[model samples]
Target: MPSKKSARLAALTVAAVCSAASTVVLTAPAHADSVRIHDIQGSTRISPYAGKQVTDVAGIVTGVRTYGSSRGFWIQDPQADDSPLTSEAIFVYTNSTPKGVAVGDAVTVSGTVQEYVPGGANTGNQSITEITKPTFTVVSSGNAVPAAKVIDAKSVPAVYSPQGDTAAGGSVNGLTLEPTKYALDYYESLEGENVQVADTRVVGATDPYSELWVTVKPWEHRNRRGGTVYGSYDSQNTGRIQIQSLGKTADFPVANVGDVLEGATSGPLDYNQFGGYTLVANRIGTLKSSGLQRETTQKQSRGELAVATYNVENLDPSDATFAEHASAIVNNLQSPDIVSLEEIQDNNGATNDGTTAADQTVQKLIDAIVAAGGPTYDWRSIDPVDKADGGEPGGNIRQVFLFNPQRVSFTDRAGGDATTAAGVTKVGGKAALTVSPGRIDPANAAFANSRKPLAGEFVFRGKTVFVIANHLNSKGGDQGLTAQFQPPARSSEVQRHAQVTALHAFVKDILDTQKNADVIALGDINDFEFSDTVKILEGDGALWSAIKSLPKSERYSYVYQGNAQTLDQILISPSIRRSCDFEYDSVHVNAEFNDQISDHDPQVLRFRP
Candidate 1:
């Protein structure tokens, strides 16, 4: 019969990679047809004895997850084979209580072998090889559980994946695992087993879901804020892993970057659909602060312009995060002269009305900025047609600019409207925008359902600086890192590449007429600094990404899945780069917090205009 614990402990069936450990010896009946759990787990990604009937399987019950749809108990063979490439423990799926079996009970079970996916086969989730419809007899109770194996810095490999086949364009999979060399192999080696990681550091913010990520090795790819910089494939970041307290244990604590887990954390490793491989801990350690403080940019001096890009993350009047955002801008970013804001929703956010104007919303933000002791800023943007620009349905999220009138002046020409496209025009022997606040290629198909680029001219210290605020296509449809495809498809970049191409053509037009035009294209580019989209925007060094000027470890304005990465960027023309006095700061306020005002932290760039 199904026990009450079955519903909550259903998650215990999720398992991960394999590893070797000292096995415990227990007395068991010498059945002629007994099978070992390691023999069924095998050495490959799939089980060797899957879908077959095993009459007698004996092991000590290390874990009892009696609740949830995946109600089962994990059994570890006391006498295990000496193979680092195979796990010793396997989950026995009973779908209900197995009568009197409990943790530390040495039981012999008979059941049919199965490969069960948590959400079933259609979800592309990995399958856990288990014994279902089990009938188990307890030989003894109150016996000691298997010793928890320790996985420290030396235990994990520095490489991410094995080299993929040449025909598959370097996609990794279907290869023999050498756990001593590759990190993925090492984790795979310990799948479905209890293990411990001691003296680890939390590398990512504890998410709203009460889960945090930790790096077993805190010295590799370390960021300024103590997060790990997710470099390209060459910089194998092997020590990062997700941590969760299975319902069987106490709630996992919410933590930030640089927090330390004192002593040892013991748990069973699980590979699930949400995060690839996670350590679901049954025992947690004390969390300590690492003295990490939030960073602020160096103040801009006289004759210098502080330009910034912030994605307010669907900011609307109804959203209660306005005051927090205003405080971040005024206090954290130090009130940049010109700020490019993305994801600004219409007056009634998500109401789905015919209204496309955001005048009230912008005015409220300006009032909040002044209330927060910031500059009296003026804003400009050409609102998009209702429901045309992509974002939250009926929210009409678009990009806009906030410039301090005392520090800079908007160079208004004439004739800019919601649908009218802007062009580069020659005014008095200098490159000038035809319309002061206008859209760049509003009618282009590349920007369909995406925020169009808002280009505007500003005069800072008597020098004209053209700025383009953009919110390109997001990384929505891309395949996940743990996707079934070896090298998961980055199909979302195709649209972003086209969008940047259009922006590049517009900037090229201005640079063609005036070779040394001061053009600053900045916003949530939604692409990485090394991405092809940024490459197309740079176009042989015509414009350089200022974030690249920062140290490789500090070049991120966003963090996702324990990887410190960059999604917001500031790319300045050669004129700004030649000045060589540019200061770029990824003001880290929001991204690394459990109660984040927005998903993305802002980027600030200060230079002589």
Candidate 2:
């Protein structure tokens, strides 16, 4: 499954789309005699016999998954089909736990052919051809399962997906499958069949759900940290496949990035709602740890002020990772002078009981930091209206500032609240906030159900530094990279674009007031550095994202579905970047490890104001 942070809105969107698409029903024709599994699967993404009934489909059960809500068995025909584009196996969608079904049993199934779309039809994910409402009889026992298809680097094509047909609204559903030409088509060709991958590198760590992602093509977009770097839209890593176990969760191997799944990992290829293509393994391989250690950034010099941004994945007081997070801050981060924390939940967390205060949550983290041999850090934040800011319900997630009082002083001007907009004012020929610890534009529609940027003024060595912390709208409900539509539509970027536009205007207001003002805007923008959202925020040269100053290989702060990319950032004004003396680091503490306190890697920026 996807991370819990973004799954709420994504689940709602998927349900709505699937509900509308399921309304269309076609009357079934007379049941035809003895159809091959490949014949039912057809040569396209959609089955030719969809909505029609087929009888006496003979195959051997290769996998029986009795666990989970969608329990079913996968059957594959031993007889070879001439067309490589059509799959020889298919999943029988039994609504409940399958009874009296085991692997290697020869059976004949009768059912209606259907195309089930994973993650809903609106997501543009390719549909899985399956048999629904199936009635099967075991013909024989202890039959050998078909040979597992090997999916190594050579078997998968370099091409990610074919160009969708323009006539069909940029969808490849109507196009014939070319397994040898495209990677998506190659995987679709072997859907529901047993497949094997040998010694694949773990690109994504084993998450809470006992699922991880691996790359068959190890060299594709590989970063120095053994992650597949998603540099651009054109280079979608086609070899990546999500792994889940059909066995007990305890038996599943825990892994991290750069680790290896030793030996042969064999499983049935299936499509699911969370990840598009998944391998439900009946046989798991041993986990070979790579000893990937957490990275530590150099401590800032006396003249430098270190600022950091970390999204603590909906942190609450009840969470047990507070100690580990505190240790990361003290040891790995070296205790930055000012830290911008995003997704800090309310006192009661996700209870949804109209609670909005996050005092307990913030205090717990501060206490843990102090216990971990860190300086006593003070904080400032404005509480949002209960459930007004989009996040876990009742959590009331918001941006917060934690500063070391011994190093820097916070300028706290009164009258800042959740609704009041913060503006720039010239105080004695210098730029200053009208209301410190205030929001950028709380009333703006761009931030209607999203977090508003919090602007605060800080004094470090007699210099005024304006800092804006933001947690913009998430990228939920967006089409995936392997979607049926070519160059899948990023619908979630619409709000992010608007959000960054408003943020840019606020930064411009500060720069317009005082041209040489030292401004540092940092937090989880929830978009990529190369994305239009970042470009909009950097428009008119008002700000520049500090992550860009590093080498291309070292710019990522988040990893999703085996793709290492940027979601957290720190942008600076002309005064900070003109000197060209800042040090930026995307600390590799959380995103690359199996044991993680957060999903995002914290970013640090050190410079003299």
Candidate 3:
């Protein structure tokens, strides 16, 4: 088993995948299958809530119970204490970008509620909500803030990770920060006048609170309607960034802390909220102009280069050519700005020698990137591989990644395949998780291993793209090969559907943001263009099969018993299709390259913001 820290990262990395998208609109109030609305004002809605049915909403999110992504997020109308007229909110993204948003952002969601009462906001036990989908639209748009930096808060206690104390520590770039105490594991605090921030800054309207009883933090990021929206600060929420007597707080001014040092908006930043020290700005400041720049995650990038993905067969690194493979990878393809590696295994019970898959794979990939001779890349892999129930005695499969330093910055990682981690599930697909690989009976809770997907963001030619790299149920003719016509029915299908569910959740998150979201869902989906999973994903038309831009004659990624099937694929949010440069290269698998190393091939797509 991997260390708890890595395991925590994995869960946080792939945490929010889950939902049942509502396609039908019902006039009846008894069910939330869909709600009919002809807004009194101009209305916008992405079908199935940007491809997800159940979503969390703030403002007046009613009809609370359990809902969304197997309860990874939920909604509630818990009566307030009655001192203030606090409205209800729906937690649409329990797993995706948890801390980016604040407590009071107004949003409207469409999804079912839950059977259980959630523990607290950061406990990770919101409830299981599946058939989930929702989008964020700005009834009111708030200022933007950086993602992982710290904003000094005197009264603000240290922030902590969801599982333990202090999510972030000290020093990044040129600035240093105090470790996060325990304000909220996944949320930014707005309770006091000064708000700690890093990464991105808030850009919104200003407020006029002369009496100054209204202390605040920036709002949370949420997905609403057809457009993406963030929280704002008004009388209801923090209206805008304003000035005040920020009380003296603890200072750890080495990283992006200490408010506007070196003429920057808290410069010298660290990416993770957990590892670095951060500072609170003592004086009022403008949202930093040049700390980190991401147009928006999941939104398409602006460029001519095509983006692609592949399963690389069982990307298991062996000793014989572990060095050789690394050399070849860097020499041949070099390091992709962001590449997703799947079917990766890590030691489960110390059975597989003392060496583990996670470490081995990261080292090899990083080594290869170094050999390739560009800027060496940073690699991140899931800690506790999502254990497939009863499968393989001790091998755990995980999706891993490598990032090119010169090309992009590693923004954040979310949601992965670990069962022990909080707010995670196998409801979408039913593969049971095991300490090892192979099969277990369908009855147990599974951290089913599919092609592990990685979610984060990167800037490609100034345009930011939020990417979800997936290697779905293999098209090896064995993974759900028996039920190609249906969405996986057996445990195998469960694993397949789990991948699908996760992908859908990803789509939901992307759509929840901006109008022109650049989303790419690529990898060995296992299902072809017409398969159940593919069809379901493309159903509402919110997503476009990026491969469709390529001629059908060239769509196949793998050969199944000699039949041409598109095992590898990409799906782009509709917002990015017309402007995206989507393409694929079968050259690797063609008569020219060795097609036998892995059954699947690679595909790419490009976007121009």
Best by lDDT: 2
Model 3 Cα lDDT, one tens digit per residue, 45-161: 112222223332323221121222222222222222221111122234343433322332233444433212122212222121222333333232242222222343343343322
| Model 1: per-residue Cα lDDT over 1-609, one tens digit each | 223244224312222222221121222233325578887677755566665667657788877765545566788887879998888888887665545667787776677666665454444444566777676666667888888888888888877666555674543434566789877767877777888888888987888666788898879899767888876745647888888775533466768888888998876776666666778777888898776666677778987899999999998889888888898899899999999999999999999978889988898898899999999999998889988899999999989899999999998878887788899989888899988799999888999998999999999888999999999999977655654345566888988989988999999999987989999999999888988889999997778899999889988888887888889999999999998988888899888776688989899989987
Local accuracy of candidate 2 as per-residue lDDT tens digits, 1-609: 233334333322100011122311334345566799998888888877888878768789999888775667899999978889889999987767777668987777778787877766777787888777787766666888899899999999999999999998898878898999999999989999999998999999999999999999989988888889887777789989999998999999889999999998998999877787899998888899988889999999999999999999999999999999899899999999999999999998999988888999999999999999999999999999887899887789999999999999999999999999998888999888999999989999999899999999999999999999999999998888778788788898999999989999999999999999999889998888888899999998899999999887778899899888999999999999998989999999999888888999999999999
Q: List ranges where model 1 is wrong by over 4 Å.
A: 1-34, 50-57, 64-73, 91-102, 105-141, 165-173, 247-250, 353-355, 413-418
Q: Which candidate, 1 or 2, has the higher TM-score?
A: 2
Where model 2 places Cα greater than 4 Å from the true spot, the runs are 1-31
**C-alpha local distance difference test of each model:** 0.80, 0.88, 0.37
Please state the error at residue 31 of candidate 2 in Å: 5.4
Q: Give lDDT: candidate 1, residue 469.
A: 96
Candidate with the greatest TM-score versus the true structure: 2
TM-score of 2: 0.94
Ranking by lDDT: 2, 1, 3
Error of 1 at 529 (Å): 1.4
Query: Cα-based RMSD of the predictions, in order?
Result: 6.6, 7.3, 26.7
Residue 418 displacement in candidate 2 (angstroms):
0.6
How displaced is residue 319 in candidate 2, in Å? 1.7
